[model samples]
Target chain A: MTGNREQLLALRQATVSFQGFVAVDRLDFSVAAGELRCLIGPNGAGKSTTLDLICGKSRITSGEIIFRGEPIHTYREFRMARTGIGRKFQVPSVFRELTVMENLEIGCSREPGVWHNLFRFSGGADTERLERLALLVGLQDELSTQAAHLSHGQTQWLEIALILAQDPALILMDEPTAGMTAHETNMTAELFNRLRGQHTLIVVEHDMGFVRDIAETISVMHQGRLLAQGTADEISEDPGVREAYLGSGGIGHA
Target chain B: MSGKLTRQFLIYGAVCLCILLVPVVVDDAFLLNKYARYLVFGMLAIALSLSWGYAGILNLGQATTFGIGSYCMAMFLKLKTVPVHTGSEGLPDFMVWNNVTELPWIWVPFQSTTFSLLAGILLPALFAALLGWFIFGGRIAGVYAAIITLAVMVVANLIIIDQQSYTGGFNGITDLAEFSFLGIDFDAYSASTYYLVAASLTVTLFLALAVSRSKTGLILQAVRDQEERVRFFGYDVALYKTFVFALSAGIAGLAGMLYTIVMEFASPTFLGVPLSLSIVIWVAVGGRQSLIGAMLGAILVTGVQGALSESEAFLETWTLIMGGLFVLIVLLMPKGLAGAIEALVRRLPQAGNGRSARHTEPDHRPETHPNLGGTQ
Candidate 1:
């Protein structure tokens, strides 16, 4: 890791407990600006919980989350979004009834209040941005298509485009390529590679191939705690990563 | 977009033209007055559609707002009819009959026509805003919200029925003086009042259409389909819901004031569950998602009921037949009459804009190939 890169987000001793069952124990984690980090773990390893804590989806039991040097653990989900953090759910959640262009336009809305939304008309600048975003996500051809009609990979790309429409500083994606074909996965990897150094991302994924393709540093979580963190190559060879995540399939499998 | 708006305007204009021709075509004053009553009901249906169809809030207590508006207008009219000119106590007959010696502080505000009219609209909207804030602010939705609103209607009815002196009890405020504004008498029996109702309905319909076509309307539907997604996008879901709920309430209030003028009375029945449920039915039968369809649905259903009840053989079984029709509509055309019409329109060769036609379908699509995505 570089020594001088400014920290964009930090979760210091954050914990989440549901009905006396600890989902995420007190744990400290931080990411630098414009860093693309991957979170990998076995089932119930608390990777998603970490993302939830940062996005204010789950209330932290007792800890601090600092975003852009300001503590944000107490903010609501929508407030956190206004502070420039966007999240992509594991299931692609787009407005099924609206067109692809409408979805992007909503994402690009500067003020989404009742009065503003009622009178706000999409200007030429917004249309240009929508077209540019659609092209970037490879959905320019389907701009007028209803989101419900999009294929699984296309929906995933649309969700990505929606998050980018917010122009957020930090993005948390839960399995960005869970149902994509091999080719689609390769394309997603390329998209993420292009996004690197432009936006900070914390992606929770299980596909080792996908992870190795886009990730520089991989953090392995186990039993609600950080088990290991290193380069994909270094983590693949670590004994802790093998015992916790790789299991019987040794590093040779990758 | 302009084409869609033009089509909407043509339909609205046709409806208005028919309404304008009613007095000329129909020789019977009774039938013309009945049609005027239907127009008032149509406004209520449009209000319900704005909330239920567009904003996704199933407001089962809509009539409570209507009742409030009606009572406000009725009180003012009752006050005017009191014989203050003959050196008699300027109290309505109902207040005098109930042995009310002094004017209540609440009734004092209704002395001014302008105050009464503003109260008729603002009171209901304020109540709706407060109730919606408590309900939606808690993030409660769907069935629970419906149950809560239905409960409110029941409570409001009971309160009106219990407060005999103030609310006129079960009989409600009656024998209202003819509504007059700016020295213009709006005789309930004349064509002038009918035109007033028609004009109000037209304005309400246009206002609703404008709101529904705005970007806010798209977001409201999105919130209906995926509320959490909208919240995750940094929009206040509760605030939007409350705004639409209050807007719907205000419209219903206006309709209530019209009902008082058309019927020459306001009763506790206006606040009852039956009327509230009927409003929902009208919107459902019309096409919950279509503003114009809801208005037409109200008129069609009311007209059908009138015709059926007047027949000698079907007099006792009219309600049963209406119930069956509602069930049939729900089962056969879940999207209601408007949805059916929209489907028919889409099939026509000239129905060029696919975007406008798409609003007729169900907003929430069932997840396809659910097993394809890996669980988190």
Candidate 2:
């Protein structure tokens, strides 16, 4: 987990064009082993599209995405994901009809083929891993509760735990706290601090306070380009970044 | 146990029993046999529930696979009826008229009942795979998938109608050889045929349970809820959809094989839109999310229609009753009969145990709030 961060994932001047519009343009970015990089942007700034490109959920129009130094453009979204780049969606996309434990169990459990999932029995490790992972995510108490009943913040945590259960070295979360109370937001910040040295986390968030607390290096995006990249204070003070975006956000104690 | 769930199960169990006992209770054995046919339809409903109820994929082409199985069964039966002199080519009269001098290559392997049964199941599975690959591969979405399958049903129906010389066309292949499993003849209307139907229904139900309880089932449900999110989670959304689609098709085929034996009739009409349409009704009316509910819906809807259609007062208007019931279930009971029964059972006054109170314990915790698996 601590060795070669640059070799793990690299996007070399990648550009994505949808029709005539460029979503993410010539963005050169990379995630290191155990790096907690926060991606902050105004709405529609392509924070999500960039992650989508690297994961193969959305194809790159040009440029290369190197995974552990191997350019992995050949892999499709699901196939590439199977290689262990676990992702968490902005919306809590869990098996809502299933119980909380069952949702985590599903994340840890991957059937060899699609057909087997339908007929094969659950192995013992799946259940054990789920219980252990639930405890890790602070969900042990609600192991059997139906996911539909979970609170919004609980759902986000469940999604994180699910990604963790996948045991991937890299985790990408979209807007981990778009709508959350200060208490939930503060707790989430604490959770991210613990994730720092263990898993390489790339979070796309709108909450500046939340971002400032967790992100070691914050990358600011404006209109599909990386406008600034540094510590929270550096990006906040950058005049170009402030004028291009963030200027409208009266961002205050209010 | 929760009172609501308990009542739901009890009501369902009671309804199943009544349907099962109808034959023994009725004065006429002939009428009782008809009730058994409706139960075969119930198996399809159960399979539908596995996908639609738990997985949330509404499959409109269940009858397509069911018809495929029936045709395979019919093919074996037709072959058996060939005169001893003509040997393998001893064409069934219909094939002779169609001038099939050589047996269709596809129909050759169905010589043994075991092979025929296997073919009946596998052919639909194979078809589902191809269809799933095309649709779930990401080209089709929502109503488009439904339309493509509906088109398949139409094409199959037209083929069944046009190939009258070979398939018995409009009438479909009939006078099917009675099922003779492992050398035991099922020619008589003994409880044997009924037993076979029951066994198949039970087995299919067991298989569905295994599927729903498995990890694949969870992925399928997840995919249904958020295909893009599931994809983002490193799942190939299309792959899950395709896999579940094939599994459902295979189970539907099993239901069809049993149906052919119970009715001893196989027609293109069985493969047509009407039967496919009826299965949708069975699923929606039974309950969209519960397998047992869907299964019960099929049996109840079919059993009631069969019973009431014969009544002197309502002989011609059973369609109206069935249609009305379908609408009523969809509108008033989004969960279907299973949901309705569960709701009813909640009011039965079980003071000893209350699930809501017990369930709230986890929610009442604070220190465990950040945990993903906790009550969330």
What shift in Å separates residue A134 of candidate 2 from its native position after superposition? Answer: 3.6
**Residue B83, candidate 2: C-alpha displacement in angstroms:** 4.8
Model 1 reproduces a share of the real contacts of: 0.56
Candidate DockQ scores, in order: 0.44, 0.43
Real interface contacts reproduced by model 2, as a fraction: 0.54
Q: Which residue pairs does candidate 1 place in steric collision? A: none
State the displacement of the C-alpha of residue B323, model 2, in Å, after optimal TM-score superposition. Answer: 1.9
Q: Estimate each model's TM-score.
A: 0.93, 0.88
TM-score for model 1? 0.93
Q: What is the TM-score of chain A in candidate 1?
A: 0.95
Candidate 2 lDDT, B138-195, residue by residue in tens: 6576778888888888887898899776678897888666777777776425566666
lDDT of 1 by residue, A136-225 (tens): 999876765778999999999999999999888999999999899999999999999999999999999988899999998888888788
Off by over 4 Å in 2: A1-6, A109-112, A115-123, A135-138, A249-254, B1-28, B82-89, B99-102, B345-356, B359-376
Off by over 4 Å in 1: A122-124, A246-254, B83-88, B350-376
